[model samples]
Target: MSNTPSQSQLHNLAQDIKQWGAELGFDSIGICGVDLRAHEPLLQSWLDAGFHGQMEYMARHGLMRARPGELLPGTLRVISARINYMPEDARCATTLEDPTLGYISRYALGRDYHKVVRKKLKLLAERLQQALPELKLNYRPFVDSAPILERPLAEQAGLGWIGKHTLLLNQQQGSLFFIGELLIDLPLPMDAPANPECGKCTACIKACPTGAIVAPYQLDARRCISYLTIEHAGPIPPELRSAIGNRIYGCDDCQLICPWNRYAPVTQESDFSPRQQLLQPELLELFSWSESEFLKVTEGSPIRRIGFERWQRNLAVALGNAPYQPRIIEALEQRQAVSSELVKEHVDWALEQQKLKKDQEQVENRQKARLIRWIKKALPFHA
Candidate 1:
């Protein structure tokens, strides 16, 4: 085997990598050794619990996910990078509270992050190869596409600690960021793990509308709004529909409730800002989009991957939760006329809610009139 680089040289290379990462738009960068043995058992238990839902790929990768060297042979160190994604001008709390407007997760509001982050990681890898040609570099860049445990690797690299929500949270940056990794053959200096800062904080757990976070650090993807809207293909479950409120896409209630997010920095990247009227679009407006229009508007967006059917499915559930109105009723009828059996079922349910509201209003009006008559009779002088 060839001789290893000196300790000073390795340390210098590590410092150079951090600087290069910053220049390439990464908010932070750190190195981690490829030994995730301690994490393997927890991963297996999560899979065994069937918490991954329909995402069989999570279990398909098996132990390779925890073993970076096995996944990409000759990998000695994993370079983890984070990029803040909360756009400076993006809508947050106000958009979520509007029952008539659709609420999309902040990260997916702009261009698809997977493509952007992967491209940057690949460019960073190329720069490293050119800088150290004598070093036999074997690197593979990945974003969310692979089965890599990105959060654990990022935490191990001292990027941040895993918060109660199971998301990586930084002391200075909070949890509003995207993570990417570059597995390489170079043996670089590793950073020490950051101290956990989420002390006795149960805000994320209590805030989840779907109760997806069963406990601290444990998530049931089947009940997660993000998973239901983006991953699951069929009709959403009935019990969670009302709780879903007017969110036509992914949900962000947990993140919004986290106190640490007060310090979350807004992203300067314009590509991450909300696009195509997604920031505060009315539920009926999005529900009225034809399949062609959906494709056109979501061209480069991550939302396009769900296809029009699942998109309609999620919209149907949101419409069911919206306040009763004639326009909403009419929109549902129009959709029901040409909608699939699955969508028609949800439309039927929404119509029932409208009928109930109308009946309740009539009963309330009659009761108020009777109470006025009783008051007039009691006051003989006024009568």
Candidate 2:
């Protein structure tokens, strides 16, 4: 082992790291010592509750997730970094209110964050390695790939506190950010934890259409729109479909309703800006895309990971909630005639919804026309 760097040198290094992180597009950087044992029981209990749904990997990771040293054989501190993902021009309120528009999670509307964050982290690690040849750094960068409890580590590093929605929230940046970590075998100065600021605020919990929050700071991933649209592989549960609205990718209801989000900084990174037709796409318009078109449009996007089948599946559910129209009926039938069994099932369900809606609209239009005729008859001159 090499001699420990002096306190002043370590402090200077921390400052340099922060500067480098900002230069590399990261909004904030903090160091956290490796001691997450306290979080193990909570993780285990959450898994035991089966809140993770079909994501068996969460349970399989066991205590390794909470113990970073064991997962990476790291000897010292972790460097946690965050990048704000909320697009500068994103219309959060309008998208939330207009259920007909597909509400993609803001984080996913742009380029895939995993690749972008990892690339920046790798560059940061390289810079550190070059700065001290004798430092003997054993560093590994991770985005959302590993079992690491990123939010808690970010909190311990003083990036932000874990909010009631279980997302890391900064006083200045709110919760519209993505977190990445660099586990290194070097001692670094750490920051004080940010104080929790979610007092008396139940907006996120109350706003959740599926009650996925379950309790404050606790999330049942099974009912979460983000989980269902992105992480889930099979057919979504029937009950949560209506609550999902037209979010074909992921949901941002909690963040939209959070009072703290008013302070969330919009990202300046061009890579995080909305691409293709993601920002204001109509449900039927997206449903009209062929599989090839879907692949082409979603190229280099995080949405591609879900594959065309699941993408169609999500859209089918959204179509069911859309106002019934002839085009919607045609779209469902077109997919049903040649789609996979899984996609076919969802299309069939959407067709049933469309039929019901058509019947209702017919009755409403007939009543409306009758009222118009009655008014005309009452005013003989207008007739």
Candidate 3:
């Protein structure tokens, strides 16, 4: 328990941390030294391209994200942990196929992962401190809350490899999981990084509805549906609205298409399960919720962070993409009457979409009727 522990002690502690992590419901855990200099240039390049879009925080931290030791003085190792978040019976394909239904990302269907993963990491850190009673442990837990480059740290820690879609993918568990870190001063023995296994696979790239995946292992966040729906604040771009489809929240298309996800296991944690209402919600039903109702339904969920205005804005786009229905037109008209400028803009767009479909249907109906009349007159013997 000395501040300057022996190599044997550090090695033993690393094993104990993994065991404790498993007991704490983590799917996997690994440790790595704070030498991410290899990744600093890549991070700088990503920011330079403005691929991060309006996420100024990503650029604000600069290279500090790749330097964990600098962010937290004396940080020697990063304890990266993974937790599976795929809910059982998510019915992703069914929901996505039904344009009338709102397809929220499976991760947000349950309680906010930031709260769940951070709490577990804090407990794990406490256990580490308790085990090393004499060693005053300086540590901090992060779950998508900081400027730290978590995926790179996770990969370096041997948890998984960064897949073509830019998410960490375990050969066995895929990418439907959350990664959290405990930056500590403990000199834990590090694990070897996982080998990349995404060879000859362009499934994720081809499957992206918005062409966000510009190349293998590269992403243009400006065109990513997840960024538009969750991160970006302004209007959903006019060009991408039709492609947005019915996904009202973060998208899972790339993950869903990855072959590795076939091995992704369903989560056992009840906290990760989808709420009954959100499991297969209709777009019209979601669009009809008042701001208070929206707040009440999404309370304690990750969806709450986007607030009601963007929530409605997203729904309006989905509704516009849905098939022509009088009820949908009525809902858009009603919402347009009292919504804010942002929501109103999307609502008006939805109205135009509905009107176009309505006109086309009417034209087709008239053509069909004329054809029927002509057939009846031409075949009088049958008549």
**Which scores better on lDDT, 1 or 3?**
3
Across residues 123-220, which tens digit of lDDT does each residue of candidate 2 receive? Answer: 99999988898867888899999988999999999998999999998888889999999999888888887889899899999989889999998999
Candidate 1, pairs of clashing residues: none
Find the candidate with the highest TM-score and give its number: 3
Global Cα RMSD, each model: 1.9, 1.6, 1.4
Ranking by TM-score: 3, 2, 1
**Which candidate ranks first by lDDT, i.e. highest?**
3
Q: Could you arrange the candidates by lDDT from highest to lowest?
A: 3, 2, 1
Question: Which of the two candidates, 2 or 3, achieves a greater lDDT against the reference?
Answer: 3
TM-score of 1: 0.95
Model 3: residue 372 alpha-carbon error in angstroms: 3.2
Better of 1 and 2 by TM-score: 2
| The 10-residue segment with the lowest total lDDT in model 2 | 92-101
> For residues 249-294, what per-residue lDDT tens digits would candidate 3 score against the true structure?
9899999999999999999878999998898999998988988999
Off by over 4 Å in 3: 378-383
- Global lDDT for candidate 1? 0.87
